[model samples]
Target: DPRSRDENGLAPIVWKREKMIPYVPTPIVYGGYLFDWSDEGIVNCVDLKTGKDVWVKRLSEGGKYSGSLLCIDGKIYGVEEGGTVTVIEAGPEFKELGTADLGDASYSTPAVANGRLYLRTFSRLKCLPAKKS
Candidate 1:
């Protein structure tokens, strides 16, 4: 509800993804849902208004996480600390488009603007052309 805000003047956590312990990824909100994940790579999509999960899935082989999730157009992009980027469709059903290997540890989230992707690793920054639908 717009009428509610936390001490920092941000909206409260409308939905909490279950079993996301130790480390929680920064969630991306779009399409009336919030997408987040656990440090172990369990991704959850929940209703925007209610805290009900639409679906949940594990990505990658499971490891530590430092980067948050990103949403562009209608796809979700996530980077694991060990350095693989996972792309999935943002919708009621779960669908992974593809993944890109960073070849090293990455702690920053991918920046998406103007249909391009900017990914950063410990030593390099890469720019990828806009993905084709």
Candidate 2:
């Protein structure tokens, strides 16, 4: 009820989807798509307009993920709790570009700024500078 105050007066939900989307580590949106993954490393790409899945792919065998996914430069970067980074092409098709192990556990989402990527793990922070063109 929009007329009253408090929790009982909140606006009604416009729509709801039956599909399961990740609740932890927040999802990211890009190019008319919503990108999210489960803690077990099942990545889901959903079309924002029709609330349909574009593609779903398993990123890892059974690695628990704590950090959120990051999208940059036409790519999606997801880090597992074990510190392995999976890079996927951001598009309708599920294409894994590559993967790298950070050699530690990561609990924080990655950050990009000034042509560099910053990642934080349980023990330390790692920075990767952008390659020169």
TM-score, each model? 0.80, 0.83
**Backbone clashes under 3 angstroms, per model:** 0, 0
Candidate 1: where are CA atoms >4 Å away? 4-24
Best by TM-score: 2
Best by lDDT: 2
lDDT: worst 10-residue window of model 1: 14-23
* TM-score of candidate 2 on Cα atoms, chains taken together: 0.83
Clashing pairs in 1: none
Error in Å for residue 3 of model 2: 20
Q: What's the lDDT for candidate 1?
A: 0.81
Candidate 2 per-residue lDDT, tens place, 76-130, comes to 8888888898888888898989899899998778899999889888999999974
Off by over 4 Å in 2: 1-15
